[model samples]
Target: MTINGDGIDNPYGKVFNQTYPGRVILSESTSRTSFAITVLQSTGMASDKMAPLLQMTLSHMSFALYNGLAGPITIFGPSSENCDEARDPILITDWGHRSAFQEWERELTGNPIRPQMNSILINVIIDHILVGIGQRYHVVRHADPKNETKFPASENGNYWIRTVPAEGCKGSEDGNELDERQGFLRYEPEEKNKPQLGNNFSWWAFGEQPLWLNFSEPTIMLLDEKKEWPGDYVIIPAENRDRWVYLVITAPKTNELGNNRTFISLAHPLHLHGHDFALLAQGNDSSQIDDPDNSVVLKFDNPPRRDVALIPAGGYLIVAFKADNPGSWLFHCHIAWHASSGLALQIMEREEDLRKTMTLEKLQQVNDGCKKWNEWFADTENLWSQNATLFQDDSGV
Candidate 1:
């Protein structure tokens, strides 16, 4: 859970981001003790290029060739209660390339985030497993005064939510001593007496631009095929260019589907592809999040930088990342059923630059793949029902 030791530490100094949602059955012997992990050798490299290494432990097992032999390897460690280690140093092998190693070391030691930055707001919905930007929608029923039951006028209405400024919010003001070591913000806001710059950038709010979400069509593929932005897809402009982009993702207590279930508010393991985001603030209580008298405290200094973060049921997660990488990247819940239910959105960063990278050959490859898939999907052997015109039940993603 702690990538480079920047997440919440428990009493034992162990990090716990999210947990298994379903029931877990533990053997009597293994209870509060050792656990087993299954590792699969899934490399296509030749035996000469492959080496036996302990997965996740970063331990070099052997440099000897395996000759394509597959077997189970047992790796036992301390119990979960006492898994914390004092120090785990990593050794970088130069492999006789001194100049190359020096260059990599320099880049690793440099600043991770850019100075000037812009931010956006993203609302995470698990009431029915759907994700969208700024807009929140509700169904309104307009019924007749005399016969309310007779009217079937259910309408969908949406509006943009006002953004909270970072100044009034309780958090850090300027970068601290842990700025470089922990990926904290080094530059101060241009405005005076406003400490909200690191927390709230004041540019975007919830429900910025809603997507024309569908069950089957992929947004990026559609964009590449058409060579234009589809009206339905949300294409956020990277106005700051190379600056960092922050996104405040909140799991509100109430949404269009009413409130999150009272019996069990599921914790969502949210993940973003392409780049690791810095988790600035993670709140657990939804009730006090917006309360003026009792606002949730955010950690702008030395926040946890990770690719995946958990949004506690009815809570919020604030993350920031540099906009240096350009492409259509997906941000979604990690749960399979949740993602399948359409809890996802695409971030089209540097559209111009992204498009330039998509060459004619790549476009043709995409088209070829699509053609083959369509043919296979249309085959009667693959269909569950012959009469049904559509086959997709959830967001194809």
Candidate 2:
């Protein structure tokens, strides 16, 4: 029910630290109730390091519960002496061991439940761009004045997302902080207090605009005279319904300022909402970038599919899925810190169909929510800047 380090005490004084219970207490139940629990590690662990242990634990637990050996079981301690030698033998000797492997193998060989054969494949490349202050701190994905392009483009009506580094970015440049042009968007309570910068500067700023508007047609607002246009945001056409989409996410190596050394290199867990995707290819090499036929070997024959996949540091991850579900889906880094720093985007699928499906009641409910938010924010005392002690560190993801 809990991870191994659930209840360990910290001798060293660490801020905001607390101990968790070793096991979850469940009340005795009848009526053939079923329950499931997932134990996750705080720090990111490699699959090779944890998968075998998880497999063994799950196998043993299933065997014990099904064979009526679960009653009055003693939870084993961490020490070697307190280890359950009796249960260790059951891992290999259990009757279900062979069946479990057989089931897994069968599932692996079965025809993969994938998008339709004629589905359109969209290629998206995500870059985790970072500017490091030192070995510890990093300023991620800030806007650059020199980069003319806001987002990358794709041919053949496919999708492509690219991170364009800004000229004179901090950590590499003489100036250490973002000036008016580079600073992130901050909500204005009054128009008189608004900064002199134009809307163009704000639109080009990374993470400045919301992908979808509750009442208006979803589109990117241009800086030149406040015009709405089809920007870099992905729009899944109605014709692509039930069609396949191939997304290739890449994280290129970032270089340091004077030395041109590798500035940041870390794997990121990318999560996509509303659907799971098959992990076609992932590796820690840049040569595999976009060369699916030669550079990398893809697992098209029944690949592993999941909602979250790791985009390796200085590498790439290729995933595929069907565009059957029509909604605005967010694709972003799973890491809280990275996502807060503008490592996210939205995919607007089947907009016409979605608009047709929206009802008056639904629209009113959304309007009501917005009205409540406005009412809440109208209280000047509750303003984020008003509270000096309060820190708005998160992106409110």
Candidate 3:
């Protein structure tokens, strides 16, 4: 076996490859505008299972079939935490200190099972999203921009999506420089509407998910006045099969740490399958791009190429790669638990890969899996609508 081919590929250059190493290949252009589902809930009832993230793999398969690609998806958009203030009860940062909140803890003990009843610990989200293909879809959530503060002026930021810490660690990237700007122009909200720069909510997109049928709300625009741009994770179809296409992943943050603690667990390895990407930047230290010290940055050009990128916790990581290869590829947190905890995603690298590897019949199974999964979620959505309440009735109660 080749040094990089251990059937398990660890993007951190640690162990085996982080994904299904020998998947088939093709081109990305033949694929259509596939789905990038963003399922964000307050870290639920402490005992939630990691079973949900499995749906991402299924979604990948489903969308891939729709475009006549392989049996599954290859490049999936990252699933970061939304942490809707309207929904999440306890900000995840307060996990170990339930009693520290005093009055809230007293009230929560008697109330119904609110997601906040057990603080939405980062550990919990990680545990759920990174179960099976955890390594493929590295976790990404929100934190205050490393460069700005929350109060008078606001900067936005991001962190892990699901996958939890190795040994039950909690909170956002702790003890790190709070002034770091991984992404963003720097947050300076002028007033409510008169955003000095951009508003703080661009970190998470609203339509990233499909129409919900259950208790949870579909990704809906909450801001009454300022709504997010309609499509964020868009996949533009390349006109010709001969052209080289690219998928650019910008891990940017703003200045606002609602519940998230720190950045990707201090160089928590991230891995993508089918094809490799050039990591443009990891933990860039620039406060301003013009400065030489910014740890976070945006690349106007391509960086380097690798299948896995180990991004430091509490920093910015950017990746750019071609949709040159195909087949069902996976992307997730290299952390096993985080992958299962809703961080896993898949991609159909390109049409050529599918054309070479997937037969018309096997592709049918991919279609079947997607159908079943969507139907299942439809029921779940309906359930959430009927009985699921994202919030406690009253923080005072």
Candidate 4:
């Protein structure tokens, strides 16, 4: 089918940093309507252990979120994460564990991951539905991951994903051209040969974090159109407006060695430049694929209306939103790097916005300039689908 823009025009380096098994889907949760959120943190494995540590936890959580969200997603951690703050740093559990048994880990793995996590373990299961579109917003944290003992302080604030502002102080009519707005300032890595600055003063130790994600407020909830919800084979919006709509997402797993791609999910608050949506289904989960009623039949004619939908790593999701606003607006993963690596896409009126922003003549000219974009995209996307160096029997990964 027509997947969201990927590869050249939008090459996805990795799905939230893991080797994407496939296009991330926002399906509806079946068992009960709820949000399946998986929150995890890894102590530094060693000095300069950022890469390996992140890899280990991401893969672990991706798989956990994928599986956990099939049911309810519960997490135990410092109080920094809100159980349902919608934009807080971390997620709290539903029930509070007052004892010394790393209650948070218990909520996640049904057991404690550590022996000394004695904070009040909370238990939280999504009690809602999985629905709506999640417009990707960027998050530019206000602090550092290593400095803060809690989240948020650890999380830089939201940084909405936007195009490079017009040049030479353009768009003066819409906005002042000579404006000294540093926020809209764009940086080009290519200028300096696109140097990889991870440890420089300009670069950060745990730098290059996402500056946006899951920040859509007026979200249109996608429901199970077939009347079957979380029980259906996959999650999606309901056919009519008579079923569950809200949904919470979780991450899928990858292997530390098998899938080394970075899948870091930084929550970015979405600040729509144009409009907003009605917040519906908040947090919930879906049914297992094997369930008889867990099948989602989509209706493109009347898709669910939403703007932002969190693409949890572990599980599949489905959401719908009406294309009301008219402009060359951005629709990305909210994670800047994710967007930069190919998770970015655009939703515009083919004729009104797209054409206005890029006239057919100019659009054609641009495409002509890069005629081979689509072709190269396919091959790059399918690179890991089937590795090439293997023998006949071992032809693919």
Model 3: what TM-score?
0.32
Q: Write the per-residue lDDT of candidate 1 for residues 248-341, one digit (tens) a residue.
A: 7766664333221111245577766566677888777766756899876767788865666777767878788788777776666644334433
Highest lDDT model number = 1
For 17-72, candidate 4 gives per-residue lDDT tens digits of 23322222222222222322223212111111111101112211222222111111
Candidate 2 backbone clash number: 2
Number of residue pairs clashing in candidate 1, backbone atoms closer than 3 angstroms, sequence gap of 3 or more or interchain: 8
Candidate 2: tens digits of C-alpha lDDT, residues 1-397: 2112213222221111122222222221122213242221111012111111111111111111212122111223344343332221111111121222222223222341111111111112124433221001112244343434585532333332332333432121233221222112322322012122222211110233322221122232111234333443323333377888777777656632222112245667776655667889888885667566767888999997566777667788899878776656656664433443335566656655666656778667556655665575456776435753422222223
For every model in order, what is the number of clashing pairs?
A: 8, 2, 102, 105
State which candidate, 1 or 4, has the greater TM-score: 1
Candidate 1 weakest lDDT stretch, 10 residues: 58-67
Instruction: State the lDDT at 94 in candidate 4.
Output: 15
- The better candidate by lDDT, 1 or 2, is 1
lDDT of 4 at 208: 24
Best by TM-score: 1
Whole-model lDDT for model 2 versus the true structure? 0.38
Better of 3 and 4 by TM-score: 3
Ranking by TM-score: 1, 2, 3, 4
